[model samples]
Target: MTNLLLALIYLAFISLGLPDSLLGSAWPEIYPGFGVPVSYAGIISMIISLGTITSSLLSDRIISRLGTGKVTAISGLLTALAILGFALAPNFWVLCACAIPYGLGAGSVDVALNNYVALHFKSTHMNWLHCSWGIGATIGPYVMGIALSGGGSWQSGYWYVSCIQLSITAILFLSLPLWRRQEPEDYGANTEESPGSDASSAHPRPLKLSQVVWIKGVKEVMTCFFCYSVMEQTTGVWGGTYLKLFKGMDAAAAAAFAGMLFLGVTLGRAASGFLSIRYSDQQLIRLGMILTAGGVLLLLMPGPAIVTVCGLMTIGLGCSPMYPAMIHATPQIFGREHSRAIIGVQMASFNVGMFVMPPLFGLIAQHLSVGFLPVYLALSLGIFALMQRRLASLYV
Candidate 1:
């Protein structure tokens, strides 16, 4: 029964992750149809991240009040509504307006579900859970590509994706019985912590924003995460447009290529999890960063289609393990009791970087050549590698 329930939850969570993944690929197509400029598209993306940041920051309070299962359901419904609104939106403003609720839904589910899985499941399950995200991310663009290839409008693509979300919501609702019946142990609660302890610590520590712990080696991990977030979000969000504008691919083909990038991430994530058990997290993270840097350099080449795809895949592989490895290492350095808040804070910083970097890339692409993207991405990757040496000592 426990296994069945978990399987169902995993499916629902993956479904939840699909929209964000698809948006990156589909936005270039959809935004133009709505008569928005590339700069405005970047703004829309920033707004979505802002909403995510807000939701994530406030999630502990919301989850405490609402409970994880209820929050998950509400988030799913809101997401579905947002998608429907996006589908029917007649103007760019309406689409941007829809992103508010959409971002809230996405961020809430992401924080809540990841927390839940981390608390309840084993380390291996973390990799599998994220792999599910990779799966959704992979499927989203491919599905959008298929819809666009069939001459369907972006609105039609959104509507179809919403249906998938709604189905996931229903499955989650049906499995609520399992979630309700399970003991706290089923979810990864430490037997040692008192029932009220988590709640007691839930209050925001007087925002000592400047007093953040700057332990040795911690800076390196943070830098790696920051750099990786910038690169991953920038590439994932803009890669489709890059392919279309610079590489001369059409909407559908570009999306398919984007899907390939996510597929590589999916494979890399699963591989990373298995390898982490055998090797040090520090070693894996360092190796991944090096590979990512190499991959970014590959993108700088004026290569054949196959070579370009391989470069994107290499980028995906390098990116795949960084997040999980970072999260895993956080507890080891900071201790488990404080790990959640620290991770949340780290994620906020990462999002800040994610929010700032991509739009700048878009703006730069407007002024310079889109070819400059690989150079910027490569620079970030190199910075991450340099930073990881400092981080390795801290985690060890």
Candidate 2:
């Protein structure tokens, strides 16, 4: 029963990832089809991010009423329908409308799933949990790449993903019975071998953000979350278009190559799952920082197409472990009692970065050179590394 339940959670995580990379992969084609400039993708994305922020804010009330099972099941359906709308929409305005529900669905499910995992899994499971998301992220663009490459429309690519999301939603509905842990505050109700499943906050109070700000390492960690999210989200949303505009690749090839970043994420997290057994989260995080920095430098260097592909993948590898490691270490850094509140604060920072920075970059792309993206990535990554070190100086 437990293994089956874990499998269900893993599937939910995968569904969480499927929609995330679609826009970046499809945008090269979508903008022209809508008779809009490439920078307009950020507008749709900002709308989606706003919806996600709204959902995250309201999730406690909604999830308390519906329970995690129902929230996940319904959010699954909502995201599926929203993606289908993306497939069927006639114009950019309709796509903007669809982003609302898609963002809401994604935000709610993300909150529910991560809360459940923190309450019922180990760090290694957390690593693999995100790895499952990596798999879906990788597949989404690959599916989009295939659709575009095969002389099919981007709509066809969305259609394929919508079908997959719908199938997952059905399974999520079917597996609702196994979530006996959902109704209770039994944060310790995980498998016996994995002791100390967290009592993370599902119902948080209005945080006195000013108070936690004084905690020695708090600001640095939050800064890390902010920078890291900006890097990952910006790359996922803009990387393919960067390839097309600068490298002169066709939309199809750029879409496929874009998946390599996520492919590296998927593969890196798979390895992180094993590495977690022997290494502390801080150590793993440091190692990831090195890899990510190296990857960004590779992007800066002029190279052949393969080097560009490998650079993206290397950045992905660097990204893969840091998020899960940071998340998994929350209890240790702040203590389990304070962990939830701080994590909530950290996520708020993450939300702000995701919502603002990517679109800011779009403005830059519109006003300046899209070719500056690699330089931008390198700068963001350097800041991220500095924050990690500062965080370590205080806590790790």
Candidate 3:
């Protein structure tokens, strides 16, 4: 039962990742199809991010009310519907409208699942579950590439992935009993505080948002989340555009290579899972920051096409373990009882970064140069490193 639940969690993570990269991969075609400027992609992203932010703020409350299993199943269904709307939308406004549900669904599942894994599973499972997400992120673009290359509309790609999400939704619906039947021991500890573990009985009262953010080290953690999110989303959303416009790759080839970024993340987290056995989460996060900075430096260099691609891959690899490592530390850094609320706020902070930074960077790229990406990324990584170090100091 434990293994089955873990498998289901892993599948949920994959479903979470599937839509994340789809817009980035398909944006080149999408913007043109809508007759909008490239920078306008940020508007749609912002809308989605806004929805996610709102949902993330409410995650703890919603999960407490509905339980993680129901929230997961329902959010998956909602996201599938939104993506299906994306598939059928005839105009950009409709596409943007669909983003509301897309973002809302994504936020609930992200907070619920991250909190679930952090509580019920080992650090290794958290790392590997995220690796599953990286795999899904990788697959989203490939589907888009195939659709575009085969002369099919980008809608086909959305339709295809939405079907996969719907399938996961069904699995979640069927697995409700598994979530309910698990004992406290089946969770990581004897306390039996899994996200779905009868929250009303266990927690009687959930933490308020104000209370969660007021905890010591919370600000630093949120700051780190913000910076890391900026770095991660900026790279995913803009890497393909950078490759095509500046690096001289064609659209299809650029999208394919952009997929490599998530591939690197997938592989990197797979490796990090083993490393977690020996290294602390803080150590891994700092190491990832170093790799991220180094990768951005490589991107700053004028070199062979392989150098740029390698740099992007390096950035993805660096980003891979950082998020999960930070999240896995939440239960320990705060307390197990506070994990769900803290994780929800952390996710909200993350979406705030995603909401503001990507579009801002797009505007910068629009007015200045796309080449500023590495500089922007490097700066954000450096700040994230500093924030993480500060967070560590609070513990020490």
Strongest candidate by TM-score:
3
CA lDDT of each candidate?
0.71, 0.79, 0.84
| C-alpha lDDT of candidate 1 relative to the true structure | 0.71
lDDT of 2 at 379: 81
Clashing pairs in 1: 119-187, 119-188, 120-187, 120-188
lDDT score for candidate 3 against the true structure? 0.84
lDDT for position 145 in model 1: 84
- Tens-digit lDDT string for candidate 2 (1-396): 668878888998988888888998899899998999987987888888788777765665566668778989999999999999999999999999999999888777776666556555666888999999877887888899999999999999999999999999999999887765544543433445333545464344434557666777888888988888877778876878877887677898997798788778888999999998898888888888888888777766775666777878888899888988888777566654455446555666688898888878988898997788887887887888888877775443
RMSD of 3: 3.5
Off by over 4 Å in 2: 25-38, 142-157, 182-185, 188-190, 193-218, 236-258, 302-309, 335-345, 361-375, 393-396
Candidate 1 per-residue lDDT over residues 142-232, each given as its tens digit: 7888889999988888889989888888777776666666534422444332111243333233223233445445456657767888778
| Model 3 alpha-carbon drift over 4 Å, by segment | 27-40, 146-152, 183-201, 240-260, 366-371, 394-396
Q: Can you write out model 3's per-residue Cα lDDT over 8-121, one digit (the tens) per residue?
A: 998898888888889978988888888988877778888888889899989988987888888999999999999999999999999989999998998988998898787776
Candidate rank order under TM-score: 3, 2, 1
Worst 10 residues of 3 by lDDT: 191-200
